[model samples]
Target: MDIYALQQDIIRYSKEIGIDKIGFTTADPFSELKARLVRQQELGYNSGFEEPDLDKRTDATLLLPGATSIISIALAYPSKLEDAPKGKKGERRGLFCRSSWGLDYHRVLKDRLTKLEAYILEIVPNATVQSMVDTGALSDRAVAERAGIGWSGKNCAIITPEFGSYVYLGEMITNIPFIPDTPMEDQCGTCTKCLDACPTDALVGPGQIDAKRCISFLTQTKDFIPMEFRKKIGNRIYGCDSCQTSCPVNKGHNHQIHKEMEPDAEIAKAELIPMLQLSNREFKAKFGHVSGAWRGKNPLQRNAIIALAHFKEEAAIPTLVELVKKDTRPVIRGTAAWALGEIGNVDMLSVLYEALEKEEEQEVRNEIEYAIDVLKNIE
Candidate 1:
């Protein structure tokens, strides 16, 4: 069968099916990806679910057994001018990162890729198709880079010229061999903007990330966020986009805006006082469909308390004290106690003092006592 013509046909069909960029590469990720994964695993730097078995996914013999070609795809989620938040300073304002601002990429991409797979079968008559997004064991970024979709930036994310790093990636593995595209060169020369802009300094070096220190991982992680990274999380209730926001490559690229991802208008700019009041049901209704849904509202709610504490918003004291009494998670309680201290509200002092008496955890008690000290000083 003619492979070059098939490649052209696939790329053309991908565009028609809503994918912004498409290219082909051999299933092999070469040595770079292997070394990176090895180093990450060696250092025990993985987060978000148990660390996956890398060998099962990366070894071609294990994945596809006889895989010959990889069809890498990118779907763009552009921002719209009208959808931008009204002001810069609010708890729940502005757009989310371009990648997750609309219908989940996993939902949109699998539908289109299924169509593409059907087209491929028509051409070859006998071919195998394996589809996956970022959720898979395969490295989507490495595959995209090898396919000439883009080069990996210092952030270790694929950076395309047309779409920057805002696009979600998917891939189709097939037995049919096609002429592979040449890899792209690293274009982030002397640019440390993403590294500099990170609040927690998660980007430790060029193209290297300690996921433990990353705010995105911390916010979504099931475990307790480290005590040090607490206040630096700012007002971001979900994922942090500070690094991407600072990248020059992402400055002006406008894709189709997904407005559904924006937070509700009434409370989008509401102060921390109200955010701490959201019931579990209320939180689910507001943010359930978003990426942050799985973590529920407790972390974000706790983060709001921390934000208020950082600002010394004494107005949030009543709500914060209420949370300290009712909240069950020790990590959340510890942070709330710290926030109450930061606000230094005398009204909360008795509550904090009482909470300290009942508190069993040493860490939580320490924070409550600290709050009591601040309240005593203010009194």
Candidate 2:
């Protein structure tokens, strides 16, 4: 069997099946990435969500024995939300980053990868293949960069010339000895826009991020958002796009080819108030299809409360008061108290005092006292 010809056939098949970009690379260990991961761990910069074992993360052979090549694929997603709803005073809306705008990209990319895997097996029946999306042990960006799908950008995104950084990445490791594609040259020279635009200064330098300080990471944590970043999170309910949106290379690169990726303006930018009251069943029914909902409702609701504080929407004061007085979760109750304080309407001071009397959690009581202090200072 001519492996080169088989590679060409796979490329053609990928395009036909809606893969925006495809490339091949040798399945050697990612030595540089291993070092970086070590440093990131040492500095406590990693988001705790990554696969824990460093050896498993960098060695493709460990994932698939005798792995000789890797197939990397990129699918461009819609950057622009067409006909998006506007947030108003009485009806404040929170934003989900562009990545969670539509049906989960994991599902979309997995579908494409499954098709590619089947085609490869048809050509090379004995091929050993393993595939992964974001949740996988292998670093998708590292695989894509090595496979020539795109160059690693200063913002830590795989920025394709065709799709910029607004692309979903996935990879398949196989024993096929396909000719590897040449890696792309880094095009991000002297651009500090992404670093400057990071609200939490999460991007410590070009191509490096301290995930602990990243607003995107912070938004997904299931605790009270650190007070320092509550204001910085703005109205974002999940993830953050400040770095990607500010990249000049990403200018005018909105791709809307995949119908599955088309944003439902209502769900993507839903009103913040309604989210505060969503039951587990209601949250799942509405947002479970989106990738951001993977962490469940606590993080989203926590961020929503912070968003309400960011907007300081007095119209939401009653709802915030209700949450503080009656919500079961202390994080939600505490966050609501903080939001109420941020709104700083002296009229709500009585409400805060009333909740303070009944609140049992020390943390929630402290939040209530803080809210009372903020309201008192306003008077």
Candidate 3:
């Protein structure tokens, strides 16, 4: 079998099946990434969401025995929402980042990878293959960068020339000695826009992220957002887009080529107040399809409370009051109390005082008391 011809055939097949970009590279151990992960762990910068096994994460051979090459594929997602709804004075909305806008890219990319895997196995009957999307052990960006899908941008995304940084990446490791493509040179020379735009200084340096401080990571957490970053989070419910939106390379790169990857404007930019009241079952029906729903509705509900506070919407007081007084989850009740304080409604003091009287949870009690103090000072 002609290896180069087979590689070209795979690339053509990838495009026909909706893969925007495809590149091949040797399954060499990612030694540099191993060092970076160690440094990240040492500095307490890790998000705790990543696969914890460092050796498995950096070595493709561990995942698939006799792995000789890796194929990286990228699917471009729509960056801009054409008919996005506008929120009024009383009604505010929260944004899920551009990446989470579509039918979860994981499923989208997995379909393509499954098809590619079957095609390869059919031709090379003895070829060993394994595939993964974001949840996989290997760093998707690192794989894509090495495979020539794009250069690793300053914001830590693979910035493809054709698709910019607005692309979803996935990879397949196989024992097929497909010749490797050349890696792209760094194109983010002297650019500080992504670093400067990071809301929480999560971009510690070019291509280095302190994930703990990142709004995207913070939003996914089940507990309270740190006080310092709450204001920075603003109306973002799931992920933050400050870095990606500010990049000059990504300015005009909205790709709507894949129909399934397009976002529902109403769901993507959802109303903040309505989010707080969603039952777990109701939440799943509405948002379960999107990637942002992975953490479930509690985190998003807490963020909605924070967003309502950010807006200082007097209209949300009743809803926030409801959450503070009767919500079963301590995080929800406490966050709502804090939002009530942030809203600075002197009148809400009575409602908080009433909740404090009945509240038993230590954290929730503290939050209610703190809110009462914040409101009392306004008098």
lDDT of 2 by residue, 1-379 (tens): 8888898899899999999999999999999999999999999999899999999999999999999999999999989988888999989999999999899999999999999999989878899899999999999999999999899998899999998999999999999988999999998888799999999999999899999999889988887777888888999999999999999989999899999999889889989999988999999999999999999999999898888888889988888888888889999999999889998799988898889888889988888898899989999
What TM-scores do the predictions have?
0.88, 0.98, 0.98
Expressed as tens digits, the lDDT of each residue in 1-379 for candidate 1 is 7777888888888778777889888876457677777887888777645327777556544577688888899877654334444532334332234454555667777887899999999888878878887777778887888999999999878899998887788988888887889999999999999999889888888888888888777767644566689778766555777877788998887676334433343333335666667788987776566555567777776666666766677666666777688888887787888888876767787788889889999988888887788779888
User: Lowest lDDT 10-mer window, candidate 2?
Assistant: 221-230
The C-alpha stretches of model 2 lying farther than 4 A from their native spots are none
Clashing residue pair totals per candidate (backbone < 3 A)? 1, 0, 0
Q: What is every candidate's alpha-carbon RMSD to the true fold? A: 2.9, 0.9, 0.9
Report every candidate's CA lDDT.
Answer: 0.74, 0.92, 0.92
Candidate 3 least-lDDT 10 residues: 319-328
Better of 1 and 3 by TM-score: 3
